[model samples]
Target: MAAPVYQAPPMPTDAEIARDVRREKRGRIGGRGALYLAATAFALFAALPFAWMLLTVFKQNSDLYDPNLNPFLYNDPPTLQNIGYLFAQTEYATFIRNTLLVAVLVVVITLLAAVPAAYSLTRLAGRWGESLGIAIFLVYLVPPTLLFIPLSRVVADLGLRNSVWSLVVVYPSFTIPFCTWLLMGFFKSIPWDIEEQAMIDGYSRIGAIWRTVLPISIPGLLTVVVFSFALTMHEFVYALAFVTSSAQKTVSIGVTTELIRGDVYFWQSLMAAAALVAIPIALLYNAFLDRFIAGFTMGAVKG
Candidate 1:
């Protein structure tokens, strides 16, 4: 036979139980409502433009010309004709190739220039070295418009006129200064002891720089690569000033010169192509974004 039966606590009265349930429900509902509001607002702010582009890229010339269809709505059955025209009618492939060539090569040039300058500035740690680096960056602030005339002369003198590779050379003039300055700040943040110890060992100065200092500054180096490539990609004024030949035109000038027919803008496809362009840069940033922020933040504090 069972020795004893354990008694359970009685359930609360309905009024008390109902009040507790209502409190939890209210909290849950309030939280959900706030989340919904935030999401809706963000969609309006960030997503609306993309939504509009998606709608337009699919819209027919008839649909686009008509004032009736809503820009915000994508109910129009999608067509890929605008994109088709963009690829088929234009030298879009060539433009992309030209742009990529410059963007990739310029990163190489910027690194070579900025890294040495940065190392020198950091190691010297004197007023002269810092001032010299700052002065170099200040040169970049001079308006491209102002420099364009003189640059034209220089471009002609170098015999790089009307060539995309002209940009591969000229862009460094602008890119190097800023990237060098940025890296200078980052380089300064690393303790000298790291490099000093490497040298104190059997490692030569160059060997120590390669094995120790540069390796540890990977984040800063990547930052320079990203900035250098980005500046090269988006550069318009210099691209326009330097490149006059249609065959040599980068995506920036190519789109405007080839796509825009009078004031009647190809708004949809233009924006679509532009939206595509930013994808790689965004991916680069997202991939190494944490390190970039860390490098900058650390550099800023050290400065």
Candidate 2:
């Protein structure tokens, strides 16, 4: 007549539970390992062309045309003669000056114009402002071929055709819309409380924007600057379209047209020249890349 002895089911031991957790963790780590491997493969794919360019620049003329030369390794005696000849033979310096001037001017003008326009739209624009902004940037999304011809006539009317100032006028068509749209997003991300507090403290709307917002949006500004600079520097279609004079030509046009004579493509010298042209751009992007990504990503998300 004794009551049945009650017994509890045995719990899983610490080691057994730990083994299950470890198994899950290992699975996660293995997935991450595969992800890293995939990323590395993509990176290598992207970088191979650049590596070839670097190798080609240093390769001798004899080695350059040879499909037999080891691509990943240096041909027995690597030389700087190609790079040396590019500088010595071509009007490389003048081309560089023209490119720099156009790029800087575009960057300055874009920031000056776009920042104010964005601020106005965000602050003072009524209900239609958002629609207007989206619509305006869409105009920029239009292909260059459609607009460049009409733009040419306009440039001639302004007497900017065949002038370096032509790029100054032309680049903003693209830069301003994107920059304005980008700044709108960055401005939205900013807390309006600080701006309102500043206005309450006797700051004008413009003053509050300049002091409270701009200082925080340096990254966004640099993104616009980088875009403007790159567009002015690399856009051959407009450059070739606008400039015909040898003395007036920008580097992009000059390098592609003026560097080679006949079918005798100066492969080594051409690549060396291109690499030189590409270096500053590479530097600019790499230096400000973080800001550029943040600005563009924020813009795309909000927009």
Q: Provide TM-scores for the models.
A: 0.82, 0.90
Model 2 lDDT tens row, 19-105:
999999999999999999999999999988877788888887677667887766776689999878867887777778888898888
Q: How accurate is candidate 1 locally (lDDT)?
A: 0.83
Error of 2 at 284 (Å): 2.3
- lDDT, residue 118, candidate 1: 83
Q: What tens digits encode model 1's per-residue C-alpha lDDT throughout 112-177?
A: 888998888868758788789879879989988898889889998999999998889888999898
